[model samples]
Target: MTTIKLHNTRTRRKEVFEPIEADNVRMYVCGPTVYDRAHIGNARPVVVFDVLNRLLRHVYGEDHVTYVRNFTDVDDKINARAAESGRPISDITAETTQWFLDDMAALGARDPDQMPRATQYIPQMVTMIEKLIADGFAYARDGHVLFRVRAYKDYGKLSGRSVDDMIAGARVEVAPYKEDPMDFVLWKPSGEDQPGWESPWSWGRPGWHIECSAMAYELLGASFDIHGGGNDLMFPHHENEVAQSCCAHPEGDFARYWMHNEMLQVEGKKMSKSLGNFFTVRDLLDQGVPGEVVRFVFLSTHYGKPMDWTAKKASEAETTLRKWRTLSEGIEPAPSVPAQVVACLADDLNTAGAITELHRLASAGDGAGVLAGAQMMGLLTDALGEWARGVDLSVYEALLADTRDKAMETKDFSDVDRIKSALIEAGVEVRMSKAGVELLPAAGFDAGKLEGLL
Candidate 1:
């Protein structure tokens, strides 16, 4: 048995992970608000935590681990998108939810054991808010139920900021109805055109933060083993969730451990629509980037650091995966992942380090070991193997070989060089030897470019 260590944001230190219940280890990750397609940044936590989820299941029996990632179908962003498109809120949410599932599937992320939608858990959200109000941690004013931030002493403990400093730094909504500026909304009234449910306070919807606390409590109990999301959620979002959950149910700790993966950048700049680098997971997949390649590139960086996505990295990942696939072709995976690889993953998900070990295994020609280790990290699976197959390079190989043969006799390699350059430009690895020429698709190989080369 291996010990798993994770950096807990709540404690602000890396500690050994000990679940509350060894028989059932539960994890809850803040899922996407389904307003539109999930961007590449959104996919980072999905892949990052998916690796952790796999590790947890492997360490514990598969049946013992329960992963829950929620869908925030109720949000201002979803409402605005619906208003802009003149579509019903339900229609927009449903379509976008499916789109999210499809996009994540393309990235090779497995669906969580329980994916509770915010809409589906409306009753639970209402019940939690009612309990908060009854417990004097929340109050209703002008049809809005707001959590009393001061009521919870450890309000700023997660993000490590005092309430006064947060009030000064944050752009809080100055509503005349609220008692304190730091107090966040538990429930807000919905317009007639907007989505809402009848609650004790009014016909309203749950605030962005309350949805997670309620849903997680409902599905994963009052406290779970691990709670995770991007570090960007560490501030008001996660902070508010902690305050409400702890106040609403003081008997149990909210989440035993907290994990936050760092943000993502593209080409050394933050990925944004204004920066012209903002693209969805679908955008990359549609542009001919395989989902496995995307997953590989993501795992190349540590989750705690800002990962930069570059065309060059994607190209290299594709090439490397192709090589590994070839090396492990027709070889059955070993019964278990290499101990070295498991140790790396257990140390706060050191995927980059694990990949280095995989490279060493490949170099050692240990195909069975490489396959087992890569699969442990959610790579080299049969499902993601389609991208590497179904392409015939024998024709190009013969053509390059014939050109090399002629170049040997004529002593003018210009024509051969031209053909080789063309193939290389199309992302084909050109190998010319005394025996013959071998052509294999490298990163970003375009089969269409090979049409006229032969």
Candidate 2:
């Protein structure tokens, strides 16, 4: 059996991964808020955890693992969007949820075993809040329920910040509801127009942090093998979950291991709308950037490192994938993935290392090995291969060859240059050699642009 190691953010070190139960390995990751399209930054954690999910399935039998990523269908952001658009909250969440699924599928991610919506788990959340109130970890006042931050002695252990430090450095909500400054809401009162559920405290909705704790408890139990999300979620969101869950269920250790992938950047700068670099996964896909190329660029950097998205990397990734697809065309994968690829992944999910070994396999001319290895990393899958067939360039290649042949005889390269320029304009790379002319699709390739080029 291949041993897997992962960097446990809670422990602050890389540790060997051992499931709580060999028969039922469980993991929970924080999912999107579903108010709008998922930005490119939001897609990083999805792909990173998807790779981890695949690795676990490989090492353990596929049936033995239970992965749960929740959908935050009820959030203030959703309410805001509903109010602004004059659309019902349910309609907005449903549409955006499907959008998230489609965009992720385009990037070759497998849906998790369980995708629990927060709204579906409201009864469970209310029950958990009741238990917390009974246990003296929470209290209700002014039609609101708030968790006592000081009740949990190890409140900041996961984030390694003291409560005082958090109050100073973090954005602590200052509400005059008879509570300490650091106390967070377990449930808050909702207005008549806002989305709310009937609760003992008031007609309200669950707080942001309580949503994950309750849903995780109901689906994955109190003690799960792993919990993962972006590092940006480490401070308040995850920290609050740790506090609330442990206090509510002291018998369980919550999540045994914590994993957090680093934030993403674009062109070596923070991605922002002000910079005009912010874009969503759908935006890139619509612009002719193959989802596989996006996944490749992501795996090119380790998950723990700050990933920089650039046009140059995308172009190089496309070229490499095209070459590998050509090499492994019509070849069945090996019975198992390459050992080196698994080993690289086991070492704290060293995806970049796994990719390097794949390069070696491609260089060795082992087409089957490359195919199996790429498939394991959620690349080169049958579902994501449609982009590889953008437009069959066979006819175009033949036309270019015939035009060049005529130009050689007529001592006039005008027609040859015209075809080459049109192909380049259409984002196709025309390679003319003494042997032959090979046309390949490049980045931003649009098949519609080649309508009149013939």
Candidate 3:
């Protein structure tokens, strides 16, 4: 068995992973709000955690690991989108939830063992909030419940910030009902027009942070093996979850190991709608970029670094996949993954390093080795292979070969030039040798563009 080391954000060091129980390795990841389509940036954490999930399952028995990711169906963003579109909040969340599922499936991400919705776990949230209040970590006033931040001595340990420094640096909301400015809301009043559940305090909804804590505790118990999300959630969201969970269940240590992936960029700039660089995963798929290409580009960069998505990288990845697919065609993968590739992944999920080993295997013409190594990293799977198949180049090869033969005899290559140019324009790589012509689809290949070429 290979030893796995992960960078623990809480300890700020790479530590060897040891589950509480060898038979039941558990993990929880903060999921999306489900108010809209998932952007490319949003897909980063999904792919990152999915890889970690795969590693854990591989190390432990397949049925030993339990992975849970939540859906925040109740949020201000969902309410706002519903209000603006004049649609029911339920309708929007349902549609966007399925959209997220479909888009992630395209990227070859397997669903977690458990996916809990915030709305479905409202009773659990209410129960936990009551425990916090009874234990004097929270206070309810004006029909609102807020957690006392300073009450917990280790409040800033995870983020490594003092209370005064956080107040100065963060955008703290000053409300009349709070005992402290840094105190966060566990539950707040919901208006008549908004969605709400009946609670002891009032008809209201749970705050953004409380949902994860409650859902995680109910589904994964008070303590779990791992908790993960993007670094963007480390400050307020994850910090608040730690405070509430620890206060509610002092017997458990919450999540033992914490992991966070870095953010993503687009073409050397932060992805923003104002810069015209913001696009969803579906956007890339609709633009004819295969999901495998997107996943490959992402894996090319280490998750700890800021990944930059570029058209050139996508083009190169597509070309690389095309070559590997041809070489590994009709080949059965090895029973287990390559040791070199697993070593790279076990060392903090060094996907870039694993990909380098894959290149070496492909260069050595080891087709079975390439297939096994690629599958371990969630690449080159059958689900994502449809894009590479169904395009037989026999007809094009025959036509190009016939055209070149006629041109060689007639000493006029006008017809050959026309045929070659047409194939090139259709994004087909035309390889001509003494033996014959071989036409392969490259990046941006459009079968529709070849309609008139034949």
Candidate 1 deviant stretches above 4 angstroms = none
Worst 10 residues of 1 by lDDT: 445-454
CA lDDT, every prediction? 0.92, 0.94, 0.93
Give all TM-scores, in the order shown: 0.97, 0.94, 0.96
lDDT of 2 by residue, 246-331 (tens): 99999999999999999999999999999999999999999889999999999999999999999999999998888788788888
| Maximum-TM-score candidate | 1
Question: Candidate 3 on 305-410: residue-level lDDT in tens?
Answer: 9999999999989989988898889989988899999899999999999999999999999989999999988998999999999888788889889988988999
lDDT of prediction 2 = 0.94
Model 1 residue 11 CA deviation (Å) reads 1.1
Error of 1 at 12 (Å): 1.2
lDDT of 3 at 372: 93
Q: What is the lDDT of candidate 3?
A: 0.93
Ranking by TM-score: 1, 3, 2
**After superposition, which runs of candidate 3 have C-alpha atoms over 4 Å from their true positions?**
402-415, 434-436, 452-454
Best by lDDT: 2
Select the stronger candidate by TM-score from 2 and 3: 3
